[model samples]
Target: MPPFVLRSPEVLLSVPTPADIDRIAVVCTDPAIAEWTTVPSPYTRADAETFVTGMVVDGWARETMFTWAVRAPGRPDGTVLGMMAIGLIPGGPGDAHAGEIGFWTAPDARGRGLTTAAGRLAADWALDPSGLALERLQWRGFEGNWASRRVAWKLGFRYEGLLRRHGVRNGTVCDDWIASLLPEDPREASEPWPQEAPTS
Candidate 1:
């Protein structure tokens, strides 16, 4: 476990500093991430640098995205385990009260439920009045990414529908699994919605 600082329940998210970029980069560049996500294949240090400097900074400065650094459970700055992003939230003047959540973990950190935990935390914060005006939290993932879909389902996101040819990954059009959690739903529950998978 790694040390970590929680974002105010109001903010619902936190940003990773440049110091955490290297470890994050290692995970982002892993074959699993590239294979499942829109992240560029052969992800490099340059891409990682952009995420820490240009992208994260610019998104924050412009209020386009809300992000968090997922640290190892007990170590605040031990290493960047992965990251989470709340995309397209209704924060700007003309924005709507909707948001999409996204996250990825290091290959070494996979299957540990960090993502599911982070999702619950972020969603709980996002739906609070002090945070974003999230009437709904949406999750969209490539159809074949069972791990990602599992995370969303574990967080009580109901599968709403599928988007055919909804996203392009490496020049290939892929279907997407679309899901959403309503503000009235109970988030942060140890148990999932009845329709969610039954864990042994």
Candidate 2:
């Protein structure tokens, strides 16, 4: 699928460009991002360049994954607030009508509803009949990533359960917190939010 823009009254979701490489590199260097995501530890400028110039370009051209940068409406592309992705899970004929949703927020963008807003826009597009027409959307994160869970929660994703050692984070095995949303699911959360364990 060709890259396109998804917009809301407050946020705009558009393609990430080479102009975003430096910002992406810096945001990805944060320990929290590396700890919770599969992004390389000690993420580099070269990695960022490859992400925008290589991976992103190929994903769109191949129609395997669609990615977007979340920014405030009318803002320059470099002032990205976050990134979002919708990846088609190839499974043959019907493709199971399934896709996975993923996102990461820039450090300064945390604690606001920006990620949720952007994700909602992208997800709605993916699920629309005129869009990807996906039947199910899966969301996964490291087991302890409450921040990510919170966003998924707000997007109406229902907690599915933890997957034992089902994911990898920077080469380390990790448990995955999984969730799913169907086209029939409510626009608001389908169930009560799960409580997070004490950090201390």
Candidate 3:
């Protein structure tokens, strides 16, 4: 229900166009994207190119994963805001129905409510039955990554628990926070989640 033509203000699962690569690449290279997330330590233009042109596109085409590129809303024209993604974690229906969310913002775009905004959008899209019959959507981040945790909390992902030494972060093992949103979730702080309850 968003106004952007290439991607919805609500979500952006579609593959980004070649025209969008440069702006997206700039955001990808931010040290923030490297420090907290699983992206290669020294992010590069080739990594960005592979992601936009290869990984994201191929994943969607193969029905193996989902990804999105966030864009700003209500400007004179659309402004590239950030990016987000949800991919089916390994498992069968009972397990695979649960997807995982990941995202980042342009350095200048942070602290402006952009990450939370994009989280709500991507959550809705990921839960859309026509898109993916997700029973739950998860957000996992290093225990100390307050920014990542905040985005998950703002979007209504309850803290399930923490896993000790659950993730390899910046070459060190770290605890992780596991949070989720069920298909039946009634409210997402910043945007509307699906109305229908999750099916078993």
Candidate 4:
């Protein structure tokens, strides 16, 4: 399958290209990202190049995973604000309709809803009956990744519970929070989340 594109009023999502390697490398260098995500510690330019040129490319070619580079509408061909991916979940006995979703936002791009917007777009496309036909989208993250948990909740993913020692980060086992979104779930935020009042 050819590269897919998803766009919203504020953001654009597309397959990562060679030109995005520099931005990817820089973004992955942020300690927060490396700490919470699977990104390599001391992330290097070579890692970014391989991800864009190898993983991203081969994933689409094999139909096993789909990734998108997120950017602002004004800089469609410029720097990426973040990245999102949907991957097939291996299952037994005729079960091939499940997928997992993951994402990370550049440090400079956080708090602007860029990652949330990008995630919404990806989920919409993946769950469409005429698109991937995926029946469920699983979301899992380290237990303390509140930001990621908030995004999943905002996307209408129902909280399932927690898994003990089910996640690994930087080679150490850790607990994980799990959630899922079904085709019938609302695409908009449905639950009330507490937030600090804006100060004038």
Candidate 5:
């Protein structure tokens, strides 16, 4: 599939380019992002350049994964707000349409719903008949990643319980929370989302 762009009222999603290396490196260095994601610890300029110029470029070229750099609308060419991607998940017979979604937001961009918006756009595109025609988009995050789980929930991904020691992250086995979104699911929260009580 050829690379494409997606835009919403507040954000723009485009394929990452070499120009984004500096920002990518900066964002990936955040301890929070590094802890919850697979990005290398102490992310470096070299790593960011390789990711943008090599992994990202090759993934799109092979049509095996689609990654987008999220930015604010006013200065779409400026700093990246986050990154989101949807990639093929090899499946067994009768499950060829499976795909997976992953994302991370810059520290400054968190709590503003930028990643949620970007995720919705990517999910819609992936499930559209005119797009990848994927039957479902799966989402997974470390067990304690309530922020990521909340984003998936807000986008109507049905909670599918936890997978014990399902994958490795930062060199350690970790449990993951799983969810899935289908084309027919409503694009709104599917269950009650309670907020923490205010601190005294």
Candidate 6:
């Protein structure tokens, strides 16, 4: 599938490019991103270059995963507020149209709905008959990642319970929370979000 853009009132999702390498590198260094995501622990400009100049472009070229660099309107071209991707979950005919969603937000961009807004646009396109037409889009985050879980919840992904030892973080296996969204599902929180445990 060709690279495309998804728009929202507060955010726009477009493919990240070589020009955004610096910003991408900076964003990936956020401790929280590495804690919950697969990004290299010590993210570097070189990694960013390979992502934007290599992986990201190749994902689109091969029609396997669609990743978008999220930014607000009028923001500088290099201002990447977040990253979102929906990758085809390889499976047999019964699961032919399944995909998985992943994302991370810049520290400064937290507490805003931009990530949520941007994600909705991505999911909408993935499930639309005229779009990817995927029957299901799953969300997985290592347990304790309430931030990512909230976004998934707000997007109406039905919580499907945890997958013990399913997620790997910085090399260690960890439990992962899983959820799924179907094309016909209402795009709203399906249940009350669990309150976060207070930090000492």
- The numbered model that scores best in TM-score is 2
- Could you give candidate 2's per-residue lDDT for residues 1-200 as a string of tens digits? 67888888878999999989998999999898888888888999999999999999999999888999989887546497889999988882367588999999998988878899998998898888999899988899998899999999999999889999999877879899999888888767778887789999
Q: Compared with the true structure, what per-residue lDDT tens digits does model 1 show for residues 1-200? A: 12224643222235687887677777887778898788877888888888888877776677656777876555455566668877765563336678888888877767777777777777876677877667878999887777888788778888788899998877799888898888887563334443544556
- Identify the runs in model 5 with alpha carbons over 4 angstroms from their true place: 74-76, 92-95, 194-200
Quality of model 4 by C-alpha lDDT: 0.88
Runs off by more than 4 Å, candidate 4? 92-94, 191-200
My TM-score estimates for the predictions, one after another, are 0.83, 0.96, 0.81, 0.92, 0.93, 0.95
Query: Clashing residue pairs in candidate 4, if any?
Result: none
Q: Give, for candidate 6, the lowest lDDT window spanning 10 residues.
A: 70-79
Candidate with more favorable, higher lDDT: 1 or 6: 6
User: Highest lDDT: which candidate?
Assistant: 6
Clashes of 6: 0
How far residue 87's Cα lies from its native spot in candidate 6, in Å, is 0.4
Candidate 6 local accuracy as lDDT?
Answer: 0.89
The digit string of per-residue lDDT tens for model 3 on 65-106 reads 666666665432345577777788878458678789988777
lDDT of 5 by residue, 1-200 (tens): 66778999978899888889998998898989988998888899999999998888888998878998999876557688899999888771246587889999999999998998999999998888888788888999998777888899999899888899997889999999899998888888988874534555
Task: Give the Cα RMSD of candidate 3.
Answer: 7.8
lDDT of 5 at 191: 83
- Residue 38 lDDT (model 2): 82
Worst 10 residues of 4 by lDDT: 191-200
RMSD of each: 5.4, 1.4, 7.8, 3.5, 2.5, 1.6
Q: Which residue runs does candidate 1 get wrong by more than 4 Å? A: 1-14, 89-94, 188-200
Candidate 5 has what TM-score? 0.93
